[model samples]
Target chain A: MKKVIGLWFALVAVALIGMSAVQTEPGLAVGDTAPDFTLRNIDGKMVSLADFPDAKGFIVTFTCNTCPYAVMYEDRLIELHQKMAAKGYPVIAIQPNDPEVQPGDSFEKMQERAKEKGFPFAYLLDEGQEIYPAYGASRTPHVFLLDKSRKVRYIGAIDDNPQDETGVTRRYVEEAVAAMEAGNEPELTFTKAIGCTIKTKKKG
Target chain B: MLKKAIRILGVVGALSLSTFLAAQEEGTPFPFTVYETYADFAPVMAQDNDTTYVINFWATWCKPCVEELPYFDSLHVNVAQKPVKVLLVSLDFRRDLTRKLVPFLAEHPLKPPVAVLLDGKYNDWIDKVSTEWDGAIPATVVYQGGKRIFHGEQFSSYSELTDLLAELKQ
Candidate 1:
């Protein structure tokens, strides 16, 4: 009986560890060192955060093709890139969804989307689905704004109104970029949005 | 003879109307409320006495969210005697209501009451729903009395949902 009870306790311990490991890690917060990554762009060129040394900061956004929330923000993301790139905070969109799970977000579809949308910024693919989890991206359209020092200054949504552009009360990304430009801390460093969960190659 | 025929037609119309009404009451199952903002939807999340509220956040576009809906419906019916209420909160875009949500609901007529959370500013309310919620769909929040439990994942089976509810009931 003593041996059986010990075995049961051991089983429970292993189960708890497994559950904790798979639980979504607490996402990166303001002032955390943003990890650098080199990923392939839609044009088949490798792009790295280090490549844009002259820029003030980077708007690292995880987004995909199939998600309705991502689709709704496509035009706005492009517009944001056009408006902010010149100011030295360019938007670097990354497709974090595993192509196996979301076929529409495959590399070829990304190329097609870039060509059709005339994207002003580089849209990269997190090839092995390794980069996003490190940043703790739980959903598509999750944004991590990093300063030139590669320190994550803000994390979360692009703005207040994802449904309607005209009704937008706050531009979270825009403000973060402006704050970085002015060498001042962003007023609101974090926000959240309802988006499609990021796809992993296999369920954990 | 004309009077008798008229009376027969009137009776038939009355019978059909009552039948239609009965089907409406049974088949219609649930009704939805539209919330234009997070503030507008907050009051519904309030804790009530002696009742367990099972609220599931979902969208029509999300496949997994649609897949596990039957479990909630099943629970709604199976737990009819228990003080439990199931609320299916749809995160579908306001524009897609008539085009997508309504039609989908018509086809899958859920037993649980449904609502469209029209809050455009998700940042304002995602945490309000649950601090642990990473804004993932198919997420569930259960409230029993004043205690609340949130699960930011889908229920793989009816038993999985029942198990969670059972825990909350205790």
Candidate 2:
């Protein structure tokens, strides 16, 4: 009877552990082929990487509406799109927060924000929060720059300065785009910054 | 009349300055050290000691970070028999040290020693903290005598944390 009870307890513990493990792969690194995704833009249109066939590359930035860090970079993102989209590198902003978790980042709010801000780029909603995990994006305002061949050339921040634009001495994304334009590899591939965690649906 | 006005202004300034310092002293309940650079903080991370260090990077504004802090506090208190050292590092901006961080600490007292990492140019030191870190907050790093493990997720329960600690020990 004692042996049976012990075995039952051990099995219960193992089952509980297995259920709680969240398997999240790390963010895609440089030289990796950027995964193509088709998400709904704020205009209620489905946008895919293949939609921009004539483009040189993409500035895939995982950002949201609620995060203060993301809010701070909103204008700069628009500026990046205006400056670089004509240069063949367009900014593709994706709202990665699960609506059930963060209501502020819901599709409705994203649409409102885009219309209010007059976003020059495609502000898409990653419905069900599936796309960010594939890209390994853990935070809002996390940037992944892909080249024309859909290869991830850079993965990190838009610049070293997150607080103040005037204080930005190193523009990481701009430099990366410039390098691709000149046929030279970007000097810095990966960088880090303090950002809000990408909101996901609460687990049972 | 000008001299008298100048004297009154000086007295008011001096009084307000003293009050500000007193508030700062009362705000922090734990042994809080402010590091202006990563060079000053690198030693704390690489401490090759017998005690297991439970280091959590957090901020006052982060909702999930604040939610999981009590677990670390409870771990600091309950794990008295074990040689554990809990360090709460505040990634709050330097300007918020007095305004937001100090007041938050005052409201919710934590048992672990806290520190403010006021280093700029985060790209330089984030990899040093953990290469796996995508610069997310509420990240925990458990280390003991060269054995280290990094988690970029919030600990929903104390058992989850203890499980990680036990795994790192092995």
Q: Which candidate is the best by lDDT?
A: 2
DockQ of 1: 0.60
- For model 1, what TM-score does chain A reach? 0.86
Q: Which runs of model 2 end up more than 4 angstroms from their true locations? A: A1-27, B1-31
Q: What is the lDDT of candidate 1?
A: 0.86
Question: Interface RMSD computed for candidate 2 is what?
Answer: 1.1
> Local error of candidate 1 at A136, Å?
0.7
Best by TM-score: 1
Off by over 4 Å in 1: A1-26, A201-204, B1-31
* Number of the top DockQ candidate: 1
- Return the clash pairs for model 2, or none: none
Q: Which docking category, incorrect, acceptable, medium or high, applies to candidate 1?
A: medium
Candidate 2 chain B weakest lDDT stretch, 10 residues: B23-32
